[model samples]
Target chain A: MPSVDNNASPPSTKKPLYEASTQFKNWRYSPDHLAHIRSTLNEAAVGVIRKTFEAYEPGSSSNVSFVTADEEHLLVTFYIHKIGQLCGHFRFPEEVEATAASYLKRFYLKNTVMDWHPKNVMLTALFLATKTTNNPISLDAYTSHIPNTIASDVLDLEFLVAQSLRFEFAVWHAHRALWGIWLDIQNLPNTPPDFAKTESAIYDSALTHVRAARLTDAEFIYTPSQIALACISLVAPDLANQWLESKENTPIPESRVDIPPRPSSTAISASLEAIRNMITNSGKVPHVEAVREVDKRLKLCKNPEKVVGTKAYLARKAEAEKKAEEKRNKKVEGQKANDRDPFGQELGEPAAKPGLVDYDDESDDE
Target chain B: MDAVERENSDRQKSWAKEQKVGEGTYAVVYRGREVSTGRRVAIKKIKVGQFKDGLDMSAIREVKYLRELKHQNVIELLDVFSSKTNLNLVLEFLDSDLEMIIKDRSLVFLPADIKSWMAMTFRGLEFCHRNFVLHRGFKMTCQVITPVLRWYRPPELLFGSRFYSSAVDIWSVGCIFAELMLRTPYLAGESDMDQLKTIFRALGTPTEQEWPGHTKLPDYVPVGQFPKTPLRDLFTAASADTLNLLSKCLLYEPRKRLSASEVCGCCSYGSPLYIIPISSPFRYPSHPSKLPKCSTQMAPRPLEEVDGNVDMAGTGPGVKAAAPSKVKLKRKLTSPADESRTRSIARKLDFTKQVNSP
Candidate 1:
C-alpha cells in the first residue's frame, strides 16, 4: 500500500505552486554546476564523434574541427533568435515563441548540436511549441513558412527533441510573471501620481528585457517571479523598490511561523539588481559571423547517421528494420497461438513476468 | 445502442485489437510492470508522427501540466519516455473513479463517504485554484466524459461568460456533491439550453439583482423566472450543514461560492464550514489507498489549452479511470555515444539508393 504518513502536513500554509514546478526541481543548477555539465557533455560528444569520423575515414578526425562548449552555446543562441523571428512570421503568440526558445535551450543542455543540428531541432521545437502552447498550425502551413524545409525535417526530430525536454512543457515564462507584477504595481499604495501615464511604455520596455533574459541562463538560475521582478526593476527601479518596501512592511500571519520572514527591501533590491545584471551581461544575440563559423563546424560534425544518403544512415536503418521485423514475426506467432485459445493466457511465457529482455531472447531462437 | 450497432461494434473490435486495457483518440493504454521494482504502472503510449501536425495536443498538455503537478489527489505521472516514434506516459494504474463508485448500485455511500469525497476533490481543486490556475477554462482542465462535464458546469459558463475563477470549480464540486447524495446527476441537462432550463427549474433563474451583471454575459439571454427549490426537496437526507455547504457552492455570484479551503473546514476566514466539524464522521478525508481498488485512473486526453478554459465535465473522479494491468514504459533511445568499427577488407561492391535523385 502507498504510505500515508504525511497526513500531519495540513492544507494550511501550502508552498507556492512554482516551488513544486519541474522547472524549480529538475532544471535548476548553480552557475558552476551548469558550466560543468555543459563542458563535460561537450567533451564527451567531441571524443565519441571523433572516433566515428575516424572509423569513416582514417585520420579524418584530425583534419576536421570539433565544436567547443562555447561555440555550441553560441550556435544554439543563434537558433533561439531565429525562433523568435519565425514566430513573428507565423504570428504565433508570445507563449509559443518563448516556449519554443525554452525548448531549444533546454534541449541543448541535454544534448549537443553536433549530434543533432540546431536548425532541425529549432524547427521541431517550434512546431512542438505550437501544439503544447495550444497554438496549433498545420504541418503544411508551417513547412511552407520556412525556406528549404520539409515536413520530415521537423517531424523526424520531434521525438528526439521531446525526449530531450523530458516531456516537461509547461514553462513558467518571465513575461507572464511580469504581467502579474505589472497588475500588482497598479494597486500599490504609494504609486507615483503620474505612474499610470507611462505604465504601458514601462511594461513594453520590461517585456523587451524579459525576451532578452530568455537567451541567457537566468531562467535556470532564477525563478520566473524573481526574473519578472528584476525586469520590472530594470524598467522602473524606484517603483519596484517602493513595491518591495510595502511588502516588507506588511505583517504575515502569526500562525504561519513556517513561512520565512520577508527579505529586507535592500536584500530584495540587491538580488533583483544581480538578476538584471545577469540578463544584461550575457543575453545579447550572438553575432552572425561568430554563429556562421560554428554552424560550418556543426555541419561537418553532425551525426552522419541522421543525415540522408549516408552509409551509416542506411546501416542503422537496416538494423532497426530487421529488429522491427523480427519482433513483428514474434508478435504474429504469439497471436496465432492466442487464436487457438482466445480466452486463455499467453501461449508461452506471460509478458508481465518475462520482461522485454526475455521476449528478445525468445525471438533470438526463431 | 441498437441504432449505431455497427459503429459501436467497430469501436469495440478496434479497441480490443489495439490495447489490452484502454484506448483513446490519440493514445493507447497498455498494461506493463516495471522489471526493476516490480511496481505496477500504466503505459499510456501516444502515437507520434501519425498526423500532419506532429505530437498530439493532448499528449503535450498531459506532459506540460501533469509533470508540474504533484499532489496525492492528482494522478501521478510516474515517468515519460519514447520508443520508436511513440511517446509513452507511465501513470499509476488505479481501478475506479468516483463516477463508477457513484454509479455502482451495489455500493452504498455513507454521509461520511460523501463528505470525504467532497473534501478530497475540493482539496485537489483548491490546490489548482490557489495557484490561480483556472481549472476547466485555461491553465488546467478537468476532462471527463460529456455527461460529467455538462452536469458540473457552472451557470456562468452556461451563460457563455468567458471569464472563470475558483468559483467555476466550486460550482462543479456542488454538482458532484449533489450526485453523491442523490446517486443521480443533480441537473442532467440534455443540451446547453436545456441545461440552463434544468438549473433554473431547480435553483431558480438568476436575475440581474441575484448575479450582478448576470444578463451582461456573452451568452446571456432573457431567462424565465422560477422560484428556488428547497434543499430538503432535492436532498431529503442531507443535514443542515451539508445544505449550507452545498448552497454556498451553488451561489449565483461566482465570487459568493465557498473556496476549497472553506469547504474542507481548514480556512482562517470565520469558518462557514465549522458546523460540519472535522471531528465529525468525515474523518480527515481518508486516503484512497485505505479503501478498496477504487483509486483514480488518469488518462489525460487532449482538450483545449488556450485562454478559454472550457471544461469536459466533472473531470473529477471519472473520465476513463480504469485500472489497466500494471505496466511501465520502457524506452529505446539512441544515445549520443555509440561507436562501432567495421573492419572491411576492401570496398568490393557499391550499392546505393536513388530515391533522392532529382
Candidate 2:
C-alpha cells in the first residue's frame, strides 16, 4: 500500500481536525476546548446560584422579575471586575485577557442569558485566564467565594461551556509582540539600566491601557498586540520619551557616526498622532474611575466573607449537597415512573393501544 | 374503536394460525393463513425488545428494497404493519427452498435438466442485478426451488460478503450449477476462510494483478501463495458449451463476470418447464389454464395421441444419460486435488482463528 503524505502541509495551514460527516460538526466547538473552559468555570460557582434564586421565588410577576434581573446584573458586573482583578494580580500576558474574552463571547453564543447565571460565566472566564497564561487555579479555591447556590451548577456548566466553544482554545494576545520588542531592545549593545527601567515602565503603562480598553467597545475589535501597543503608548509616553532622550544624550560610546540614528521627535509625534486617531476611531474610551471601581469591587467580591470560614463554608457546602440529593431522588423517581408505565399511561395508553393493534391484525388476517 | 384496538382484533383472528418457519437476526418469519381470503402468507414478526439498538434505519433497509422488487423470480412482499411491540411483514409463502432439495441426495438431474435450472437461476439473478440488489446471502438456502429441484442462483452471491454488488449473487449461481452437475457443494468449507480456500483450489487463487482491488477486500490476506490453475482442470468432465458458460459465470473479477441477462442468453439448454412435464409421470387432460405459459415459447410437442409409453432414456435429444465413468473421472481429477490443496492452505489459515468472525 502507498503511504499517504500526512505531513505534506505545514501545521499552520492544516485541514480541519474533524471529517465532514463527523458529529463534531454539530457540536458548538471542539470537544477538548469546551472541556477546558467548562472545567475552569464549573457551574457550582455560577449555574446553581441563578437556579436557586429562580426557584426560591418562581413567577413572571414584575417584582419577581425585577429582583432577579437586579441580582443577575450585579452578579455579571462582579464577574467582569474579578476578571480585571485577575488580569492585574497574575500580571497575565495580554493574550490571556483576549483569550478569556473570546472564550466568554463564544460561550455565550450558544448559551442564553437565562440558562446559566452570569456569575458562573465570569468564574469560567477567570479560570480560562489562568490557563491561557499557563497558570491553573484549583477549582476548590476558585469556587470558594461563590455562594452555595451559585457554586452548585459550576461543574455541570463547565461541560456545557466547553462544548459551546468547540475546544479550539488557542488564543493569541497582543503582549507577545510587545515582549518581543522588549527582548530586541535588551540585546542592543550599551543599553543602560535606567533606559531598560524606563522601557519596563512603558510596558506596564501599556498593560494599564489594555486593561482600560477592555471596558470599552475597542476591546472587541483590537487584537491583543495592537491593544498592548496602543495602551502602552497612551499610558506612559513620558517613560518612552525619556528612554529616547537618554539614548540620544549618551550615544557614540563607539565610533559609530555612520550608524543610522533613531527617529526624531517630529516623527515620534506624527506616529503618536496616528495611534490616537486609531484609538478614537475604534470606540469611546471607558471612564477610568468606573473601570477602577469595577475592578476593585470585583477583587473584593470574588472572595466575599459569606463564602469563606470553616463553619459558614461547611453550612453552605452541606446545603448544596442536600439540594443535589433532592435532585437525584427526583430524577430516579421520574425514571421509575416511566418504566412502570411503559405505555405512557399518563397520556392514556390503555385507551390507545387496543385500537391501534387490534384493527391492523384483523385486516392482515382477512 | 381506535386503530390499535382494531389492529389487535385483526391480529387475534389470524394469530391462532401463525406458525413459526424461521428466525433471522431481527425477525421471526411465521407461516400464516388469511382466514377471510383463504390466502397463505408468510408473516415476518420483528420484536422491538430483541433489537440491541431499538428500531433503527438499517433494519428497514432490506424491507424497503425488497418491497419494490416485483420480479417473478424474487420473493414478493405483500404488506407491512406495526403494533406497539412488534413490526409485522407479510410476504408470499414459498413452498420449499432449494437447499432442502440439494440436501436430498436421492434426486438426480439430466444434462438438459441441469442446464434449464442454470438458465432460470441466471434469469432471476440478472433481474436482481439490473435492479441494483446484491442479494448478498445467495446460498442454496436463500433460493426457492418452487415445486421441485432446479438451479436459480447467481455466482457473485456464492461469494458471501455484504460489501459486494449484484456480482455476489452470480457467484452463488455458479455454486448451484456445480451442485447440479456433481450433486454436492462446489466449495463446502466449514468456515469463511476454508470456503475461500475451497474456491481458490477450484477456481485457482486470485493474484493482485488479476484482481486489481482484491488486496483492498476487508477479509483479503496472503494465505500460502498458490499457483493459478486453468478452469478446464476444475470442470474437466463438463461439455464444451457448459464449460464456456461456467467459466464466464465464475470469473474472479466481479466486473468481468457475466450479468444475469447475459447468463440467460448464454444458456445452451432449453427452458426448465419442458423438462418438468417430461419428468412428471402424470398425463394431463388437454386444458390451456392447467398449463403455465413460458415467457419464451418452446417448439410445440404433439398434443393428441402422445405415447404414454415414451422411453425415459431417449425422450429428448438434449437429455443425456448419467455415466458412472464421467462422475469417477471428475471426482478423481478435481476433488482430490482440491482436498489436498485446501488442507495445505487450511494449515496456513490457522493464524486467522484468533480474529473473531464478524
Candidate 3:
C-alpha cells in the first residue's frame, strides 16, 4: 500500500511568503500595493531605456560575448539562480522567468556590461521584456512592488531607466553565449584543462546563487553577464578566471587589478556593495537583517571549497536522492493501490523486500 | 412560432399599440404616448432580423446619418430603442404630406405661398447637400407639406436616380413649382422611364453638345438623338424671370444645376410671376365649418375624404371645379403629338440603360 504522506512539505509555499515579506519591508508595503508599484516602475524604466538605446545607436550591431567551455556551466548556474530569485521575489509565473531569461540573453548580444549600468538596464529590460513573452504582468503589478515610503520617488527613477534604454525590452544571457562557445570549441581539438567538469560544477552552483540573488534586488545593479560571471567564480573561481583571462588574451592589466581577478568575485562584491549602500541610504537596519539571511546563503556558495564534496554535501545529496526515489515509489504504489481497492485485493508484491530489511538492519547497527 | 418571429410579432403589436401609427416594410411608425407624462410621440419599430444583408441598409444608413443631422425643415428622428427582435426608430409625427396639398383642389396656393414653400425646400435641401446626403427618395409622398402649399421637393428626385446628388431635390422643387403653376404634375410619367421622357420633353432632350457628360450618364443610350428644344418652347407662358430660374434648375448636367442655397437666394417672392395681388379673387374660404375638421397630429387621412370629390361636398363654388377642368383642357390642347412622343421617349429612357451604360 502507498504511504499516505500528505504531510510532506508543500514546495514553494514558505519560500514565496518569506520572499513577499522581505520584498514588502524593503519596499515598505503590502503585496498588492507593491506589485502595482513594481509594475509601474518597471514599465516606465523600460520605456526610457528603449528610447535611449534607439536614439544613441540606431541600427547598431549586437555586442554578444563568446563563451568558453569552462565558463558555460557557471553561466547556466547564474541563470538558474536568477530564475529562482525571480520566482521567489515577484512570485512570477514560470513563463515570466523564462521570458526574462531570454530577454537577458538577447540584450547581451548587442550590449556589454560596461555600455550601461546593468543594474538599471536589467530591470528595464525585464519590465519591457514581459511584452514579447506571453502572460505579461501589468504595469500596476510591477509598480506595486516598490516600497510605499519612497514609491513616488521611484516612479521617476523607473521612468529614467526606461528612457535610458529606449524601451528595448529584449536581453541576452551568458548561458547562451556559453553554449555558442561550447559549440564552437567542439570543432577544435585540445580541450582546456578541467574545462568541462568545472563548467558543469559552476553551472550547478551558479544556478542556486543566482536564484538567491534575484530575490535581493541585485538585478537592479548588476548586468546579467556580471551576475553569471560572479556565480561561476563562486562555484569554480579558478576555472572562471582562467576562461575570462583566456578571452582577454592579456595578463591582468594593472588598471583592472582593483576589480577582482575572478568574474564571480567581482559580481559578488558589486552585488554586496549595492545592497549595503541601499541599506545604509534607506536608514532601515531592520530590513538588513532579512537581507543578511540571503547574504549568509550567498556566502556559503561564495567560498565553494567549503561545501564542495564535503560530508554535508554528500549527506544532502544522499538524502535528496533517497527522497526522490521514495517519491517515485509512492506514485507507483498509489496507482496500484487504487486499482486493487476496487477488488479488495493486493496486486504486485513490494519489490525487493530484502533491500528494506537490509536498510533496517544497517540503521539498527548504527 | 420561431423565437425571432414571435419576438418581432410581439414588438410589432406593442409598437402598433404604443405609437398607434401604421406599419411600413422596415419599421412600424407608431403614435407614441408617454405613459407617465401622457405626451404624444411617434415611434417607428425596426426589426433587427430584417436588417441582415443590406435589407435594412436603407434604414441603417438613415439612422446612422440622420442621427447627426439636426435641421428645422427636415423630419426629426427623435429616439431609438432595440430588443431581441426589433430596432425601434422614434420620429416626430407630421400632419400631412405634400401630395395631399397638391391634390387638394379646394386649396389653391397663392404665388407667395408657393414661393415660401420653394424657399423652405431649398433651405432643407441646402443642409442635406452640405452634409453629403442625397435625399434619394424625395417625392410629394415623402414631403410633409406644412399647413401651407410649399414646393417641398426637388426635380432630380422626381426623375428616379437613387445615386443622384442634392440636384435631385432641386429637380423635385422644379416639379413642385411647375405643379403650382399648372395645377398638375409637370413630369407625371407612369414609370421611371416615362418620368425621364416627361422631363426630357419639357426641358428639351439634352444632347452631348449641351451636356458634356450626358452620354456618360449611367443610363445614357444613343437613342435617335433629338435636337435640344429651347426653354421658351416648354414654358412659353411662364414669366421671363421664372423661366430663367426654372431653366437653371433643370440643367441636365448635375454640376450645371443651381444649388439649393442659390435657388433660395435667386428665386424671390417679389418677382412679377409670384407677386399676386392680395385682392385677387382666388382666396380660400375662411370658415372652419366649410372645411373638413382634419387632425394635424395624426398621419394623413384618406385622400378621398381630404381632396377627392370636393365638388360633391358642395362647400366650394362651381367656378373652382370648372377652373381645373379648363386648365386640364388647355394642357391637352397644347400637344397630343407631344404626349405620344413623350411616351415613346420614356420607353427609351430606361433606368437599366443608365445602369448598363456606365
Candidate 4:
C-alpha cells in the first residue's frame, strides 16, 4: 500500500500563533510594558492586583489582597488537569481536551480567578470545547456525565468565555502536526527497521510530550508546527534532525508533507529550550494556604458587596436599577404608541427609532 | 442590557436579515444582506437546546471545518455571531445546488453541465480531504439532496464501520454522478438492508477477495450471490469516460475507490467541463418554458418508474409506465415518491399556520 502523506498543511498557516496569542494576551495583560488593567506576577501582575483591589475593597482592610500570578496559574492548572480527567472519562477526542485547556488558559489571562469561579468556567470551557471540536454532547448528557452539575452552569458561562476570547474559536493543537511529522519520519529511507516495531510507543510518548506542552505558555509564543517539531526533538533528537535534514531536495511533494517551512536550527533549539523552561518553571507547586486564600478572595470578588457592604455598593446598585427602570418605561411608552398609531408613518411621525421598533415587536408580541 | 448582550447585538446589527428562506431540523435559515455592504448571505440560525445538549453536532462540524477551509467551490462560513443563545452562521448564499438542478425534470442536464458540477463537487471534496476533514453526511444532507434518502450512504457505513474515512464521501459523489445521468436516485433503497441489496444488485455482491477485511465489519452480512451489472447498462446514456469514472468511485473496496484528486485526474473530469464538448445523438428535451410546471408533474413518473423498472428487470421504461399492476402496487404500499407526496401535503397544511410562527 502506498504511504498516504498524513501531513497536509499545518493548521498554523491559516491562523498564526502570534496573531491569536496577541488577541488573548492584550485582552488579559496591558499593552504598555509598565502596567496592566489587571496584572499577573510575570507580565500582567500589577493589573490583576489593582483590578482585584478595585473590585473587592473590604473597607480598606489589608487581609483580602489579590493572589500572585503564580497562585492564579496553580489554581487554573489544577482545574485544567481536572478537565483532562473529565474528557478522559467521557472518552472525548484529544482535540476536545486541548481546546478546553486552551480556552481555560486564555480565560484566566484576562480575568482574575476572583471574577469568574473556575469551577463552572472550567466545565463551560470543556462543553464549549467539545462543540468546537465537533464532538458535542447534549447539555444534559454533558452535565450528567460529571457528578453534581447542571446544564445552566455550563451554558451560562459559554458566552463569557467566547466573548473573552473574542469568539475566535479556531484552535490548532500540536497532536496533528506531531502525527504529520511522525508519518514523514517513518517513510524516510534512513529510518531503522526496529523503529517501525516501536512506532506505537514512540507515538504515545510524543503525544504525552505534546500534552505537556499545552500546559505551558509556549502555545501563545510559538506556532503549532514549531511546537510539534520541538516536542519531536525532545522525544527523539536523532529522528528530529533527520526529519529536518530530509526537507532539502526531497522528492516528496510539499503538500504531502504539510510541514511549515522549517525554522533555523538555532530557532528550533531555542523553541525546544523555551518549552523545556516552561515545563521546569511550571513544576513548582504553590503553598496550599496561598491557593485557599486566593479562592476565598475570588468568592468575595465575584460578589463584591458581600465584602464591601458599603454605601458605594448600594449607591451603584440603585443607579443601575434606576437606569433599567427608565429604559423599561421608555420601551412601554414606545410600544403603546406603536399599538395606537399603526399608521404612524403615514401621519408623518418620526421614522421609527432604528433599534427601538424591532425590540418592541419581538418582546411585546403585538 | 449587560455588556455581553450589547456586544452580541452589536455584532447582529451588522447583518440585516431580509427574510427566512428555509428551515432545517435544527436551524432556521434566512437570506440576509450585510448592513454595511449589502452583500447577500445565508444566515443559518442554529436552534438552541434541541438536543439535551448545548449545541448540535452538525453545527459544530460545519463550523469547525468551514472556518479553516477556504475554497470557491465550498460554502464559506463568513462570520459567526450569537443573537442571545442562537448562533447565527453567515454563509455564502448559493443561488442553486446540483440536487435542485437534477430534480428539476424540465431542465435538461447537458453533459457539459453535469461535468462542471461534478468537477466543482470533487474539487471541494479534494480540498477537504487534503485538509484531513471529512464530510461525514455528504449526499444525505438537505444541501445536496432530499434529506431522507440514505441512497448514497457508502457500504462502509452500512457495514457499521465507524472508522471510515473520506472514501465514504467519494462513494456518495459516484451516486450523485449516476443520478445526474439517470435523472433520479441511482439506488433509492428504503432501509439500510434494502439499500445494500439495491447497491449489490446494481454492482455485484462483494466477495471477500474483492473487498478484503469487509467481512470483519461490525454489521457485515452474507447475501445471495449477484453478478455485476455493467455501468454502461445502468447509466444507459453515459459516455465511456463518464462510466469509467463512475465505476472507480463505486468500487466495493473503499481503498480502491478513487480519491478526490484521483477522480479529478480521470479522462472525463481531467480538463475543464467545456473543454471537450459532448456531442450526443439523443438530445434531451430542452428546459421547459417554466420549470415548476413540468417538475410538479414529470418528476413523479421518472421517480417511481425508475424504481419499478429496477425491480422488474425484464420490463423496459415503456412497459413500467404502461403496467397498471405496478402502479397499483406502488400506490397500495408506500414508496419514496408517496412519502414525498405526503410530505408535500403536510407542508401545504402548515402554510395556513405559518402566520406568527417562528
Tens-digit lDDT track of model 4 for A5-34: 222223333333334343333423222321
Native contacts matched by each model: 0.39, 0.01, 0.00, 0.17
The CA lDDT of each predicted structure is 0.65, 0.44, 0.41, 0.59
The CA lDDT at B14 in model 1 is 28
True contacts kept of 2: 0.01
Q: Could you give the DockQ of candidate 1? A: 0.20
**Docking class of predicted structure 1:** incorrect
Ranking by TM-score: 1, 4, 2, 3
lDDT by residue for model 3 (B1-358), tens: 2122344334334432242345433344455654445544456545435322211223334453445444545555555444334555555444344445556676655554544445445555555555454453334543222211122223333333334555655665666667756767666665445555656666667766666755555555443444567767756655565666766676777778777655533222121222211222422212211222112234423111111221221211111011000000001112344332321000000000000000
Better of 3 and 4 by lDDT: 4
Relative to the real complex, the DockQ score for model 3 comes to 0.00
lDDT of 4: 0.59
Residue-by-residue lDDT tens digits, candidate 1, B1-358: 1112233233222221112355444455565566456655556666664666777554565566667766555556777766555666776544234555555576676665555555556655555555544445211112233344566778888887755666776786677678778988788888778888889999998877778998888898766778987988978878776787788889989888878766554444343343232434554444433321122333434421122232312222212111111011111112323112111010000000000000
**Superior candidate under TM-score, 2 versus 4:** 4
Ranking under lDDT, best-scoring first? 1, 4, 2, 3
Please give the lDDT score at residue B263 for candidate 3. Answer: 51
On DockQ, the leading prediction is 1
Interface RMSD of 4: 12.9
Between 3 and 4, whose DockQ is larger? 4
User: Mind giving the per-residue lDDT tens digits that candidate 2 earns over B11-104?
Assistant: 4465323555554444455667676786766666655444322332222333434444444445555655554346566666543334444455
TM-score of 4: 0.71
Q: Fnat of candidate 1, please?
A: 0.39
